[model samples]
Target: MNQELSESLDKSCKDLYKEETKYFDYIKKIKETAPNLKNYKTNKSKKIDQAFESILSYHEEAREVIQRKIRYANEGLKTTNLLIKKYVQQELISKLPGWEGSSNPPPLCGKIPANNNYIASNGDLVAASIPDENTGSAIILCHVKTYSKTTQEYKLVDFFEDLNKGPSYYTLPKEDVIPIPRTLSSKHLSQTEFSKNEKVLAVYPETTTFYPAIVLESPGSRTKKGFDTFYYSLRFVNDFVEQIEVYARFVIPNNEK
Candidate 1:
């Protein structure tokens, strides 16, 4: 039985190697094709740009898929090694009592179970600050997913509120406020998640002293697609300030299960 299992494991490893080699060859072909595609002249710059963008996007997605496959293969190799050492050898298996197998935590942030649905709905929150001379203001930007058939474009909401809740609440009328439309470039479209870039605005609004933070939420449709939500908080403070802190929480429907 042990010998059969070892042979099976060896075959799996060989199959994985072949798959890896195929993926590497595909990547090389993509790299070789990129320069030729770039040199092709077209009358319409917009059409050319769009075509190039699609190619890049396909390349990126394919790369991610290949990487995930490689990761799975490596994990399988580790599991096979532990199984052989324990069951086949028998020496190590007798010494350790109640040892099921060698356990490994998740790749990111330890063994915390991630909420994929939330990530799909609310894109991601990113914050940054702009400081010039004696004056500077913090910005909190939320990238809300509006990619469904019902919705047209992504929405970014900026808030000027205290990081720590106080009695005073900053309020601005919707009509009075004007939000600058942020253009999406090819680089921005490639990312599965959203991240805001810091910019120094000409006019700083008058508001109470407050740290900045952002909350990202995906659309309801995206949650149904099984993508975990991502949330991030950032605080910008002057060099003189002592403590800077932020916290975030999310609620999802059908969360009882």
Candidate 2:
């Protein structure tokens, strides 16, 4: 069990520290690039600034938040190590010979193996996005499980609300959609057609899929090269709650498509 505790501690802290590094990198990137865009004549530049403002506004605040999380995770690791040592030295040593005689069973005592190759009901950790009902797109942790005798499905909790309160559910195969709504016209709608709160189909990054989303902001228009373009901020339709920045060509009107 000490090994398991150690492994879990390492996994949790490793991820937290990784995230802390990412936050610092993000802050650094913002500092390095955001100010340089001040003189640019594009509305997209303003959008970039606005997009990072909330994060950049309180650099100290962001640092404090990330530092607090790192500190908490470190403290947790220390506590886990102390507890593991206390149990082994103070209690388990005397009871190991007569293991069945203890009134309370020791948790994690030879119950979970330290070998990482063993696949539990949940498979390896994977990066995934889920369809969100309330917020559009939601990022979630999932365990890949055999949905049937042959098919594999991800066992995940709903990303919204209290995830621990509900029964476990599996991701369906059909949810991995390439949303090609055939209702749309061949010519894309202009940026002027998109309005705030309008439901539209927009492209998800790095996927051929288009997701239903709501337009959060249409931050005016800008002319580039010989043509005009518009930038939009969108929140996805289902479990994906992450806000995305999209060009006008990517934001399809609900009436047309």
Candidate 3:
């Protein structure tokens, strides 16, 4: 179903492009014909009048075709968005802890949402306010999994350090945790701005999790929201010779004092 919707969207886009091309061609004809009839001195008056009529006809026809194509394109876009949203919600439900599938489970993958004042479901990554290091006045990334819904409590932290005992979940309230931002979902949890040679944590060739890394070059993007919307080259901290290009969204701050 998703594939069919995607193909429909592609065809709709192509049709819109064809309509736009036709509109441009009509405009080009008007421009070419108008310049040739300068003051009607060299050209016959009947010819000039006929040329004006042709230009007006082309303009009206282009407007009609373009408007019709735009309406069709909008309907296609709306259907595509609705289907995609449905699939995403279904996938999110499958990723929740203790979720069981009918025959096959939906694939679980996506960026964890950022902080917001609401109840986060199980499988969410969040930030727990802890004292400096142990929770006096510090913070760390955690994963949310409901151990007891009646008490409004959860087990946070689903990751582990390298060579550790693997990931585990600890207990905390939904109120104590802030859902981490998607920008920080796969990042090192540092400040937003990263300069050249600045220290950072980045996901590997992919975004499973963040590892210690350093920025290697200038950030690049179309707009002014640098780290929030840029790409940077980075080198991992533990490894010596494995540099990778990462989107700014995947680059994050290391939990430093």
Candidate number with greatest TM-score: 3
TM-score of each: 0.23, 0.26, 0.32
Candidates' lDDT values, in order? 0.33, 0.47, 0.53
Output the lDDT of residue 22, model 3: 78
Clash totals, every prediction: 12, 14, 10
Clashes in predicted model 2: 14
What does candidate 2's lDDT look like per residue over 137-246, in tens digits?
A: 64443435433324534354322111222335546552331112112111223323356688876655433234678887653422223232344678887745567765
The better-scoring model by lDDT among 2 and 3 is: 3
- Give residue 65's error in model 1 in angstroms: 1.3
TM-score of 3: 0.32
Please provide, for model 3 over 15-79, each residue's C-alpha lDDT reduced to its tens digit, 9 standing for 90 to 100.
87677677767666765676566574554766866766777677677667767776776787666
Worst 10 residues of 2 by lDDT: 177-186
Q: What's the best-to-worst order under TM-score?
A: 3, 2, 1
User: How large an RMSD does model 3 have?
Assistant: 19.5
